[model samples]
Target: MNQNAEYSAVNDAVRGQFLRRTWAMITPYWRSEEKGRAWLLLAALIGLSLFSVAISVWINHWYKDFYNALEKKDTAAFWQLIGYFGAIAAVAILGAVYRLYLTQMLTIRWRAWLTEKHFARWLADKNYYQLEQGGYTDNPDQRISEDLNNFTSNTLGLGLGLLRNIVSLVSFSIILWGVSGSIEVFGFTIPGYMFWCALVYAGIGSWITHLIGRRLIGLSNQQQRFEADLRFSMVRVRENAESIALYNGVPNENQRLSARFGKVWRNFWDIMKVSKRLTFFTAGYEQIAIIFPFIVAAPRYFAGKIELGELMQINSAFGNVQGNFSWFISAYADLASWRATSDRLLSFHQAMSENEQRAPAIDVRPEGERLVVNDLGMDLADGRHLLTDADMTVEPGQRVMLSGRSGSGKSTLLRAMGHLWPAGHGSIRLPAARYLFLPQKPYLPIGTLKAALSYPQADSVYPPERYAQVLETCRLPHLVGRLDEANHWQRMLSPGEQQRLAFARALLFAPQWLYMDEATSAMDEEDEATLYQALIDELPGLSIVSVGHRSSLKRFHGRHVRIEGGRLQEQLVS
Candidate 1:
């Protein structure tokens, strides 16, 4: 096949895949446990939509009688038709209002359910971390937050609008066909001439519309990605504002941010150019449609073959039929946006699925009280060995210190033990008990001190007095009384303070097995020794494994293991 044919085939396949993925994303909600309420609300909303179409048909008929009464100068009939119009208008208005209100309600409920489901899937089995490590998807934060929102809202709005247009098309086409009377063309009757005119007009318009606006889908996708990239950059600046300010790096930061925003600006300009062209055609198409019906039906009216009322009704019915056929043209831009959102969401879901199904190179199982590593080997994502033939074991109550040169996989080994690093071959047997892993830099969620202290656990997990005591034991006595004070703790607290706070968490949770990768590096050796001694005293039988360069950490750990020549070796401590 030619290059263009190949591209077309690929595009068609992508579109088909998108539709199937979209259905998979949407069908679960309707078939879920909440299906009963979801279906009932959907049925009611659809009924309201259909009722509005019925009223439109009634009004189309009313046009004939009302205009005829005016033409005949019949005062009583005119007034009676006016009253009928008022009643029909009232019902139509009510139907429209209720339909919109119910649609919004359903949209929010669907969004909530989908958001929760995405959260569960993304967080399950550490899929979020794995996706980041694998580099399988970009800006998962945007996918979960922005793309999901757009998907739920646009899906409901566009899907229901399509349904309403289909109903209107059926209702109005029947009226138009009956009222338009057959046209005698070359001795053969061309029935439903008005309907045929609407179809042909709209068909040509839709074809041109697709030609003009086909690029918008790809552009919209790029626009969203660029916007998200810029936003993420800004967030990174805000998050590291203190560091940037300390280094006086405003100029460099600004240049980086501007570079990211440049992509957004350029893509938005392209979107604007395409949208302007699309709007020109769509607007002209709509404006001409207003008079097109009258121009087509005027001949019969002037010939006295049809009365003024019938002419007016034909115009109204024709507009409705034509508008139904022109749905794609009117909604082209929003459809592009919807397609882009669906594409991002589906890609994110597929990435998560891939990560979930990935076979781990390292197999971790909970077997006994001792943490064991048998013939452990670590490799980078590119298949470069970081560690080879390393083996070690830590029994209950043993304080083991992992000593290694920088970039010798000390931290990576800790990650492997935690089961977060999978690009390696090993059988690690962990203790069947609670365990905690602390990195060099502690994570303090932007919330209350109590919440941060009890992170990954509810505040109610421990009593207020216990939290205060743990804080005091970790040398953060000043923060004990401010348990409920909410702030960005990571920003407010210094590195040493954050490290101390992590110790407070360890003290609170008191896990049976604790792994620390330079967890106390920011602290003074005196304070680090004090905290380690306190942990050993308070949490009896705690199997503590720590990775650090400071010799001060030696006094805390009873066994010393060093990574030498890519293998683990136990050393006798003096």
Candidate 2:
């Protein structure tokens, strides 16, 4: 697509469909098991807001008597009115405090649920890795942490604020209408005098505010993206601080970060310019609004048709009506931010769903108590075939070794078996899906050493003794004692040691089938042979399919499979 066409596509998506789609992302948590808590928080916050509105109305009534007493120069009456005002103020203050507390509580609950849901979907089907592989989801870290937090927080707060404002309008409109009695505007007496004035004033102001602030939505959206990009750059720098320092990359890092932050600077400048213009108009509108009611009621007061008290009461009522109607003005920035957050969350949700629909290469099914690959093929993401015309099988206790030249789809085959290779074509018939794939560089998840070894499984499933035995047998005796130590195990441990831990893990689980991709290559031949022997001795029924390029590995497997020139080399072990 052309640049103009792409811009048009994005513009249309933001305006037309994305917002409606955002609501779908919001419903699951509210309708799920957590619905009771969600509704409870919502009701409590809403009640507080409504109670605040009622307090405002009561104070409006108090305004009339207070001003009447003042106009009469009655000291005692004035003091009595002040006491009444103080009492009403206390309730309003309490209402405001509880309102804030409840809103924050609601925000965290909603954000927690949303964050977890996204985390699961993103990590569940290996969506995080696949999303990156396909270039499907953008800035997943941002989406999960910052964007999810912003989405739930702003959506709940802004949505509730909107609801409260609507209710306030309904409640205050009546009061305003009653205050402004019908009077002759142009030789005809109009019904509900205060209602007509309030309506006209609010309508004109709201239209002008919308017109002035319409550019804010796009600005806000751009600002958020720019900010996220800048923040991501900073986080990258932090993560790679050691490498950058070793290479003396301060100047380069500074330049790169400056470029990223420059986007933030430029976009913020645009927002600032627009904000300056908006502030002038909104501020002027507010200043004039304070006196507008009194101006409309002034003529009646001078005609001796209404007292000073009535004028003051009318002023307060009109202010309430105007306040309720001007919610858009009060929340314009938040609305803009919410729109941007909604756009991000909506895109994330859609990307996850689209990924679920995407076709993957590996087809998993059970076949007669043996792991089998029938016409199995592996391809790169771009449809370039990697492994072609491959076939293999392993029954229980049948240990097999896979050998292939580099770039011969060795790891790709293993990935396919694990159902992580979604880009390739062909079906893999497995004994069961519970099989584990131990990569040459095993993943040490962020937690205890025990948790790292028992990755993709709960630590509670294995006993301490089991964890201890595997660590010792795999030549990871150093880690055996530190099973409870928690850290980023991959970065913390040496490659050889990590590989050792991987084999140690294989010892703990009685996996029906195991796919080891160069899993023992990092270790010495003796250690490798010992670990393989330990597996055979400990779990004789364990079926193993391993990929490695070592002569020593031949003795460990009863069968050998090799791949060359994108096809499996059919040479069996004796």
Candidate 3:
């Protein structure tokens, strides 16, 4: 990967479109139902932060009195100062503890709100399905699970830290000016010369820190993506463990996994290299800053222009001013990380917004008594036509079976009818009735059998007896007793058993219009025949549109249609 080019692209995006999208993502939460609580928490944190800075200012003055008492060897004055210091310390500690507690409370609340909102959009209007089919985005799972978390915590941390430093900078600059007095340099008398010295020192450090650490923004972004990809590859292996084992594909899987990790390792090495250079500069800069104040103030001290007390105060005040001014230098790494996280979240937000706004090629409406396809056309992502100007309609209570050559459009037609495919221009009007589609491989969510059986619906929607009856009718008597038992049903059951569970689901759901896309392919002819007969006897008025290759399916359907040469041709079903 060309890191420079990628860095440029991400940098350009962050500069141009980052803030608008970021604001859009952030503002909704504050304006949401939790606005009252959010603003209250924010106010408390800000107040506590300012309080902590005030305590620092108080401690700076104490340094003057405490040092003078020591210089005079006044035992009573020194003891009195020590007692005062204890009181100030107690107040400072109390403020610091509450500040941390409140910050955590607000971060979690904000994260939860943003996560729920993103989840809704991801699943809304079938956006998840559309995004997967179009391949318009990658690993939305990670974006939601990881990126939002990083964005929330970093944004709060950086924002509050900056605010605290700004206040500190203003507060300490005044103190440094008054105590350092005046200095004559090259026959020119300079006022607040020490403040100027501290400013220039921090200014140079901040500039150098940015120059060395800017690449980390892009590197961090790439690192996150590479890590997610590696994790996803391993997850795929686990999901398909049986298939991989049957083929003895361990070597190939291992090679693929290793290649993904190679990208992560190389990119992280680049991160370490840049970080090493940055660390060298920052560490040296901080060490020099510690003694730089004393070096600048020493001449006046030796000249008897100021007492030991004022000189010590000058050191304490100068440290605060310089540290506050160098906030950017100290936080450069965190700033880079925050910006990278912001860019990722911004891109994800934009992709979802675009999907929501774009006009789909195939317009599907739900406003009819029968399923209607009018001039329905479908195409591959490459623009190769799958089905062209095909018109078909199924009346209420009709059982129709559609068949075609593999890859000819059998499945695409079903997807278009279901409003999932958008690569082709057409219109499909679905009946205003409950409908369900069973794909070749049924999805059994990892949960209780009753929950999986009642998927897309709560388990409470059906009684216990109804679930048991449906399971028995679908020839899954074994599972009938295990409805309350939870397991990963997809991995635990055989393919044939999973299909049977899908039928049990359909029987439980009882949709008026049913569509099956090779849903029975995993079952034997006898089992498939038994299930079809059960459906016919159980739901006499249920309409089914099935796409399959088995001849046994023909006996259940009163009408047969075949797609040939990108068109639907009617067939006589004996």
Q: Backbone collision count in every prediction?
A: 0, 1, 0
Model 2: CA > 4 A from native? 1-19, 182-188, 191-194, 234-252, 524-526, 550-552, 572-574
Write down the worst ten-residue block by lDDT for model 3.
Answer: 1-10
| Model 1 misplaced regions, further than 4 Å | 1-13
Shift in Å, residue 141, candidate 2: 3.3
- Residues 464-552 of candidate 3 have per-residue lDDT tens digits of 99999998898899887798999999999999999999998999888999999999999999989989888888887999999999998
**In candidate 2, where is summed lDDT lowest over 10 consecutive residues?**
1-10
Full ranking by TM-score: 3, 1, 2
Question: What TM-score does each of the candidates earn?
Answer: 0.96, 0.89, 0.97
lDDT of 2 by residue, 350-438 (tens): 66777888866577656567777878878775678887777776777788888877887888887777777876556887785457788
The CA-based lDDT of model 1 is what?
A: 0.89
Q: Evaluate all candidate structures by whole-model CA lDDT and list the values in order.
A: 0.89, 0.80, 0.90
lDDT of 3 at 71: 94
